[model samples]
Target: MKKLCLGLPKGSLQEATIDMMKKAGYTVIVNSRSYYPTIDDDEISVRLIRPQDMSRYIEKGIIDAGLTGADWVKEAESDVRVVVSLIYAKQQLTKVKWVLAVPETSAIHTVNDLQGKKIATELVNVTRRYLAERGIVADIEFSHGATEAKAPDLVDAIVELTETGNSLRANKLRIVETIMESSTLLIANHNAWEDEWKRTKIENLAMLFEGAIIAREKVGLKMNVPNGALDQVLKKLPALRKPTISSLSEGAGYAIETVLDETIARKITPELKRAGAEGIIEYPLNKVIL
Candidate 1:
């Protein structure tokens, strides 16, 4: 069987990626000591790679496609095809940032203050380029792990990736500058992207992934409304598309259904009830591919 080798980020993004795949209609199984994961799709083989290294692997065509942070692509300077931007992180459905931080008590309060200081980060090349653009001369050191803790003593300042500022605050670090903001990207190898089969497969997966992400923030609502109060109920609804309304049997009013943001669904449920909506049902959605 012809198979497309796929790389899934192993560290922070692993669990989230696996869950996303499940929601997108794929089952991915990973063993404790295995780098290769078993995905239900026989046409696609899965391997676990670090997000930082994902771009390089894709650039080399080691894997047909993979999911990783956009920052890593720029950091690696890898030539690859970005299939789609998946805006999600390990903790939340939002972009993550690489920021320049210093100890809260440090004298450095701005990027210029790092003129000749040493900095620590896993993203060495990107950090170097960022400082170079500002004409700031600083020593950029490569940190294997625990980059947030290398400041104040081992390094004068540090460049770290954060979803929230909680970790930085806990480490007593203050952000002086935001270097870059990145979201997860579904990327493909240049060569693989030119192949019809692989391209179609990658695009299908990207579509499904996007649908699952959108579904996470939305829900489906269905209710019955008296014909006399139809206008009121309709006014209370906020929908991605027009609210779906159908007349009931004989003289019964209408059965209305629509998809809307989860937050809006909650707030408007009471208003809908007051508007004469009956048998109201709010349900979870697996996918919303509009």
Candidate 2:
């Protein structure tokens, strides 16, 4: 069996990364505190490490590929080929953010207010670059973990990833400015592509992962509608293609199904129901392919 070295990010990216792998038909089983995990696929060798170190290992040709944030790739300046953007972690594929935040009750209310203030974060380079662009300077302090708690105590503000900002609010912090927005990127070494067999396998992995992301954004909507409303429903329904229309069991109407964005779901569902559709079902997708 061929081996494909894989770097899975530790910390915040670990859970989501592993989950994505499982959803993509690979199971990573860890029995100890070790960095290495047992993967179900014979083609993959999985190692868990901090995302900050991922690009270096890839750049050095130690790992064949990795599931790390795009921010880390840029911060570490690793020369690895990015094959796909995992749609987890930050929903947006690009232009992600790490924000500078301060306590809501504190005097610091905006980005300008953060000037000359002490800000703590793990992303020093990202913070520095963002602050440089805005022409505002701050005393950036690096924190390994618990950076949120240190804010307003050991520091006045913090630069961190904002996903729903629930944690920031729970820690009594409000975003003052966005530092850097990042998305998880799949990267492989330049040399990895040199091996004909390995490169083909890597590309296959990328295809499967990308399909999983597409699947998450969509759902398989199946319903039965009056044959009379078929044309009208087709006009109103937003699907990847013409809704799959099949004859109903009793020959009452047509059974239709399609792939659609989850965002427009709620609105379209009621319309389907109003259009004399029944057995309307929306299911979470695991994989989608064109």
Per-residue lDDT tens digits for candidate 1, residues 139-205, read: 9999998998898889999999999999999999999999999999999998999999999999999
Q: Candidate 1 — what's its lDDT?
A: 0.93
> How would you encode candidate 2's per-residue C-alpha lDDT over 1-290 as one tens digit per residue?
78889888887667767777776778888756788999988877888878899999988999988888888887776788988876577333334568878888889877788789898888888778777888888899778888889877799888887777888989888887776667888898889978888888888888878777777778889988887888777777888876788998787889889999988877789887887788999999887766
Model 2, runs deviating above 4 Å: 90-96, 105-115, 133-137, 224-227, 246-253, 262-270, 278-282
Clashing pairs in 2: 96-181, 96-182, 97-180, 97-181, 98-180
Candidate number of the best TM-score: 1
lDDT of 2 at 6: 87
CA lDDT of 244 in candidate 1? 90
Candidate 2: residue 145 Cα off by (Å) = 1.7
lDDT of each: 0.93, 0.81
